[model samples]
Target: MTWRRALSVALALALALLLLLVVYDRPLRLMPWRKRSAQPEAAERRTNRGPALATLGRGKGDGVDLFKGEPLLGEEHIFFVETSCALDKPQHVPYDSESGLRLSPRGACAVEAAAAAHPTHRVYLVHTCDVHRRSLAKDAAPAYALAALSIPNVRLWAVPYALHFVGTPLQGWLASGALRASRWPVVHASDVLRFLLLWKYGGTYLDLDVLMLRSLGEKKNFGCAESPAAVSVGAFNFALDDPGRRVANACIAELLDYRPDLWSYNGPGAITRALKKVCDVQEVLEMTEEMCGGFRLLSTSTFYAIPWQNWNLFFTEESSEEIMMMIGKNLAVHVWNALSHNTTIYTSSEQPYAQIARRVCPNVVAAVGDTM
Candidate 1:
């Protein structure tokens, strides 16, 4: 063939090869996936993998001072920003003088109910002050707070607005092959800052999107579960011990000064890793399908379940309904996809989740019902 013809043939082959690579990339990554073994020996090793620290009530040791020095339970400020991604068309849903938006009710209820259920445990709702957020309009927080106030135990806190990052500086320098690529720094920073505030003030941290079915103290042990099918420990419940808090604070502080990469931001991962080195991981209680529908705090050999994997398990139709019912059974039905709901609850906003809470956790509902 002529030289021009040969060049054209080579280009066509290269294009075909590139297209083939792209098509098969996902399957290739998914194939040959190893199932994690749940051997008894492995579980035992993981349980005791960390060093011996001071023992707490649940036969778990509280070693090293993670936080500077602080109390574990108190008035925790729980904030859920309707991240640019999570919100729907509304700038902010209307807050009737009576009830709140139906979108984030369950999460709001969890904080409010948990706070009311345990007076010693205070939970304040925190919202990002960023009004010009890409997705939803501002006032969503205020609307949410109005509904939450009806619950008696819930309080509201607001952070000064800050600009949302398009991407952290660290992304450019890091290779996709590196672990840091998976990290979400802006979101992590917000979460970590909240935790720092909780630790410094002596309280707990909770994501607004999650529902609380049982008492953290009752659960005792801390291990990640795959949510929906299993709840992964992302930035969820943890007692604010000095060392743990310090580790969290240090992680965020370090990110601000050093890495400047959002992808490497692992708040819970950092604290859990540090604690695992010195403390025993307690027995992970299973949040079964009966109580967890698609989501449950699953039993894993590791300290916490992987969030991405666990949440992906939540997307299926089978997983979603199962998790919803389970939440109705064990905890309140969370409805993580609350923003998707289009109806307005005008009379009493808390009624939907409250009805489920009454049915599932009757005693808790009875106790807090009058308050509501």
Candidate 2:
């Protein structure tokens, strides 16, 4: 009788242990720490595969190529905007196609320089006009744009304004046709688009004329001051996360009081006004990152090392070595294309612009042999 009782006790202990294991298995696997630990590994895998392009939205019959995978936009992107009719109508400038408008050599040089300077970051050449891939075939697209696109990190894309402005504060204003009625339609449109782009998909925005001199590094949510008093929207950075979104939202909101008749009202003016909402504009000049809620204001040397008033310096024959020394620590040089568009750059000439092009955008310099 004692031996039989011992056998029953052993069997009961085994059954109780098995029941506990069965009950805890699923819950243990579903713990919060397990999911938290998996996120970093997944992100690492995506980064190792290199940057990929994804289609955001496309209309019927739109010839834009849909890349089909990866995130649409992120902190790793650097964007350049082309808002003029230059994509469809010839600007009679260097690299302009006889059949249609194409990217200018200077523009291509800008894109190339950015890609070369920041190999890890993806550079996007965004056009406000409709772009058909068929239109970008060998004969239609200029050699400069083609050469720039050959770089692994450079991409050309056309995004619709309506799609970009959808959920933002600019949506109702854009839908009202106020943009069409503006005296400076192209200028105002460019301003509106920049703010909207930053608001939706945060990243660095550079005017097509801005040339990158070095890696932008991990700088996020910042703008360059054109002078001691005001910030320039020509080159700015806004991250894709929460902090960036807040400042971008403020800039978009300022557009509600858009001034169509004023030239700088929407572009530089909007950004300055937006900053005023959070802090004293004068304090921004002091270079404090915490001034406007983590928004840093870089000095004039960073982007506008050569101001627009001195735009002629780029084309004039000067000491290339001295110019380089002046802007050596500068992250970029804004060529002030708005004021310097009429000026011509020749390969045979040894001007500051030509010299910089040879070093930064050698491929473009080689493509457009004599002039740019």
* lDDT for each candidate structure: 0.37, 0.72
In model 2, where do residues sit more than 4 Å from their true spots?
A: 1-75, 85-101, 280-287
What's the lDDT for residue 187 in model 1? 52
Worst 10 residues of 1 by lDDT: 49-58
Error of 2 at 119 (Å): 1.3
Best by TM-score: 2
Please give the lDDT score for candidate 1: 0.37
The candidate that achieves the highest lDDT relative to the unseen native structure: 2
Model 2 TM-score, 2 decimals: 0.77
lDDT of 1 by residue, 51-121 (tens): 11111111124121111111223334333433222112223443322212222444445555566545544
Q: Quote the lDDT for 13 in model 2.
A: 97
Per-residue lDDT of 182 in model 1: 27
